[model samples]
Target: MALSLCCAWISILLLLLPSLSHGGKLLVVPMVGSHWLSMQEVVEKLSERGHEVVVLVPEVSWQMETTQAYKVVTHPVSQTLEELDNSFQEYVAVHLTQKPFPLNALAMYNTSVHVFNSFFGQCKDLFRSQETLRFLNQSGFDALLTDPAFMCGTILAHHLSLPFVFFMRGFPCNLHFAAPQCSSPLSYVPRLFSFNSDHMTFFQRVENTLISLLELDYCNGFYGEALKLSSEVLQRDVSLMDLVNSAAIWILRFDFVFEYVRPVMPNMVFVGGINCAKKKPLPKEIAPSLLNCGHAISLHNVCELEGWDFSFLFQISLMLFDRLMESPLNLINKAKNNILNKNIRIKLYLRHSITSGPRRVGAGLRFKRQILAGSTI
Candidate 1:
């Protein structure tokens, strides 16, 4: 069975290159975090490059609601979301004598993981999943790209029986896994994990390990069990991990570029920057993280509460630049309108009428002069 799966992917990946040579469609599913918006450029660029790409994102097309889908993502996404939110609150607190030191990793990790699991449990049964399924059944996607954050990509590939390519948008906790199961609780415990960073100080590495422990908790509680049910939903005991992990030796792990270009295994290629030809630099909000500071988290001086992820900060920057770019365009349009206004033309005519000294050649002047000359004669 594994060999058959291997053969299937080999055939598809082999086809992926030739199809790109001709023009193929790339169907991508976005994870609902910082990486969500980042994938937009990849989709846009592929579309620009004569390839068609349709992105199926969780929150991009939908509004926030307390429905099934909302509950599903809110927990997992919101836990971290709140910690991030509270950082700003804490920052303000200390600024106004709230607390001497800022909120630390322990609190932040706990907050995020709680939110992360709420939805991680039932993403499939969430809203529009059937619609997504229906669309995928007909979409005829040439390639598959998904973030491992949600194990849905592997699920989709297996059900559709399509060629599979797994993407870990961020760094794996097990930099060089002693075990394929990166989900071990040991991986997440602070100070217990190492992320292949030789340069990291002792304390930083400890922090990385703790973060990994938090991740392990999330997976065991949410992601793993969710995946175990996936086989039931798909009506077969397909080792979802095979597609999630590497089912076969020659299969592709498509996380080409991360913050730090660590020496990874051949099976794990950092093809992240590969989706787009050049690179998309990290946001200014992002700086290097310490400990198992895998590529996923970029921590800068854990200052108390800032209420914004580096991702959201980048979005705001883009929005400000957009508004600024439109200002000159708006001004030029206003100037054009001022020029075109007939009221201005009328005002100019009135000014000319008022400034008219006695006319140089008046209608009555010639007649009056003729009459005067005749009388004199």
Candidate 2:
């Protein structure tokens, strides 16, 4: 009878063991705007996988909506949403309107400094909230996830002495590679904004080298205020590299198909197509149009094409399409006439991924091949 009772107790303990342990607790500090959108995907997935997720957001923000997937903690910020929006708009306006290289570069630098200053001000306000800081310190979070572009999360993670992961498309001045000690040779690896392909000419390589050299100064200027604020918060001398170098992992939103080949570290993970993981059925209004169209072209409005005439390009595209069609000459003529007479419906599908130059060109070529093979867009 004693042996049987002991066996029964052991079986009960085994059954309850699984339920006794719980998923890890994660704290996420995401940046504003589109950056938050990408990070939110990961946050929700972690929650679904049984981990406890807590997201920190400013009281006033753009696109940081409350969701059931994770617990959101709002902290007081000094800057208002209107002020943030206006600064961002000013930066975008400068980027889009200024075309001359030297003029545009100077304008971009000035506007970016203004924007960074405003963001740093918000970071300072977060640190001032003792209640929020106390809560975070006592939360007993297993790890931290954040976007380093904003710098606030990284600073907080360091302050709390938590191992953190970085989620981003890329960092300004190649900080992503540099902070992680990843190899990035300038000979073929292009610097950001250099617009150089992997196959570089002699002169292009030289330009790439020069740009790489200038990146240090640019980064310092861009993050000067941020570095100072970080030191003040930590109560010690600190640099951007110090804050980022100790990251446990980096989740980069990059794919080889769209990005040039480059060396990466083991801790750096490339989840390029993570944004496309969630699939939804096409809307009723857009689905039929895609199926019925003979050919479709998507134009993303990244910035204003000041002098380019899109209508003429549309006509040219249609003409090329007509030539590429392997149909009877009579059928081809009839189709061309019908398309022209029907005014050639042009639909613009603006997606975040299409913003990159290589991806945009690759998508256009893929669409062209699809159309030639008698497939709908």
Candidate 3:
């Protein structure tokens, strides 16, 4: 009887183990902007695994009700959506017109700081609220998962004395924050606003260095105002940058294949392509062209081309060969010989929006042609 009772107790404990291990309240604070679906999925997955999640959002797109899994706490701000739209438009306009005038670096930095200042300032009530602060302090959250794009979340985590983790839902541009300060070499890695590729000419490297300096300047320009606001809310002087640097881990939404090769810190992790789904079958119209195609080249990161253009190129291999004639001209010459013998096999895989298609083709024509044109075979 004693042995049987002990076995039954063991079985009961096995069933209870999962719930006990995962029973912790998690708090997620995302940047107040569009395209937050990635973070929402993270919250949902945690809730599904028996962890209670509480997400503080600027706007509640769905009805908020307490369930066994999660809850939503909404704090709507006063700024209209129109104001957000206008600010983004102004930023774009400044970037487009920056090329003609000299001293564009200073011009762009001033514009960028102004834009983010207005946007982040609008959320002061959400971050600096006495009521919100009190609620968060008493909520017994285990840890915080937040985006570092806006430093308010970092400030809140510091105020609440909670360890913070980063979940960057967009491109990973803030490598300087993740790595040791000034560790990321400005010689090759492009700035967020700079449209240059990882490979750079000597002059391009100099331009990239200048752009990076401006980015650092713009990011730190509004620190005084941010520090003042956060200190008043926390009831103590806090170093916001220090709080950000103390992150337990940073999850980036990028793939190594798409990014330039660079050293990353141990605390930094990549969970890229989290949103990608299984590929569907190609449509009937496009299927035939690729069926018996010879060697194909996939250009990664070219601008979007019309679907019809792809089909047309595949239909006539000769026309496709024509496209390669300008750059990689030797490839075209080789391709002509292969076509005559009916055994051409070249496959090109183009990556997504690295730059404009024309510029890529133009650059290729300039460089690859000269080198290959001199080759004997």
Query: lDDT tens string, model 1, 1-377?
Result: 99999999999988777443567866665565445544555556666777766655444222222322111222111224344334334432222222222244334434434544444434554323665577677978777766656666656666776665544544233422322443323322333223335366667666666566564454454445455667676776644344455422112234423233334445554444344343333344432222233322222332343443443443433443333232222111111111211111100111111232421110100111212211211
RMSD in angstroms between candidate 3 and the native structure over all alpha carbons? 11.8
- In candidate 2, what residue range of length 10 has the lowest lDDT sum? 358-367
List lDDT for all candidates, in order: 0.43, 0.73, 0.59
Give the lDDT ranking, best first.
2, 3, 1
What's the CA error at residue 9 for candidate 3, in Å?
15
Per-residue error for 33 in candidate 2, Å, reads: 1.1
Best-fitting candidate, scored by lDDT: 2
Cα lDDT of model 3 by residue, 112-161, tens digit: 76666766764586774567767888999999988766666777787788
TM-score of structure candidate 2 = 0.73
Point out where model 3 deviates above 4 Å: 1-20, 59-69, 92-108, 169-182, 192-195, 210-215, 222-224, 234-240, 277-349, 352-377
lDDT score for residue 254 of model 3:
66
- Cα lDDT tens digits for candidate 2, 209-279: 98899887898888888788888888999877898889999999877555666677899998887855654
